[model samples]
Target: MIYAYIAVMAITTYLVRALPLTIFRGKITNKYIRSFLKYVPCACLSAMIFPSILFATNHIISGAVGLLVAILFALRNKSLVIVAASSCVAVYVTELLMTLI
Candidate 1:
């Protein structure tokens, strides 16, 4: 039963990924559609990641602090490493302060 479930999942995942490639043979030339598609991945990734970020730390406040720090760094066009490191530090400091209070 577990094997069957795994097989079904694998097939469904493969089809979802493969169907797009087989169907879209030509370049997508519509400007609106192209622009929408360009941001889709980022939107999807954020949707998946944002919730987890909020729950990753001991307290929600720390997670929010980290998110804010990350966003500020990102808006400033900082490097990935800088953004990530700063966010981690912010979370850590927030957690420490929360513990003290």
Candidate 2:
């Protein structure tokens, strides 16, 4: 039964990825469609990552503070390393302060 379920899921996943390639053989020429497609990966990535960002820490408030710091760093066009490090630091400091208080 578990094997059957796994097979079904595998087939469904394969079909989803295969169908798009088979259907969209020609280049998409519509400007609006092109623009939307360009942002889809980022949108999808954000959707997947944003929730984890808020809940990864012991405290939601610390997580939010880290998220804010990360966003601020991103707005300034900081390097990925810098953004991530600063966010981690922010979360650590927030957590420490919360513990002390």
Candidate 3:
């Protein structure tokens, strides 16, 4: 049963990712679509980061600290790897301290 579920999930994931390329192979030439495609990674990255910073257990303090570091990293033109890693480390350290008392 578990193997069947895993197989289904794997197939579904592959199909969803492949469907767009297969359908749009030689047909995607709109300027707006091209511009939007360029921003997809940034939009997805923000979507993944914002909620965790805003709603974590410590709320204001944790959120502020993480947001500050993230902004600094962004302003300095740091790589995504550094920005994500630093923010995660800050959040983890903040959470650990919050739980200690």
Candidate 4:
């Protein structure tokens, strides 16, 4: 039963990916549709990242510091590696200080 469900899910996922490229041979021309599609990944990523980020550390201040650092890096148009590393550093430093205080 689990194998059957997995097979069905695999086929559905495959079709979702394959059908779009196969059907949309021409470049998408609608500006609004293109704009919406462009932001989808960002929206999806934020939805996935935000709640986990907030609750990740035992100390709320640590998470907030990390989140603030990440936002600053993003606003400055830093690369992903920079944003991620800086956020981790911010969280670690904040948590370390929190433990001592």
Query: In candidate 1, what are the lDDT values of residues 1-101, reduced to their tens digit?
Result: 99999999999999999999999999999999999999999999899778889999888899999999999999999999999999999999999988889
Span of ten consecutive residues with least summed lDDT in model 3:
51-60
Which residue runs of candidate 1 sit more than 4 Å off their true CA positions? Answer: 45-52
Error in Å for residue 44 of model 1: 3.1
Q: Which runs in model 4 stand beyond 4 Å of their true positions?
A: 1-12
Off by over 4 Å in 3: 55-60
* Model 4 per-residue lDDT tens digits across residues 1-100: 9999999999999999999889988878899999998999999998988878779987777888999999999999999999999999999999888889
Ranking by TM-score: 1, 3, 2, 4
Estimate the Cα RMSD of every predicted model relative to the unseen true structure: 2.4, 2.8, 2.9, 3.0
Best by TM-score: 1
* Deviation from native of the Cα of residue 21 in model 2, angstroms: 6.1
Give Cα distance to truth, residue 9, candidate 2, Å.
Answer: 8.1
Per-structure clash totals for the candidates: 0, 0, 0, 0
Position 87, candidate 3: lDDT: 82
- Give the per-residue lDDT digits (tens) of candidate 3, residues 1-101: 99999999999999999998888778568999988999999999889877666776465677777887878997999999999788877877877888885
Give me candidate 4's TM-score against the actual structure. 0.63
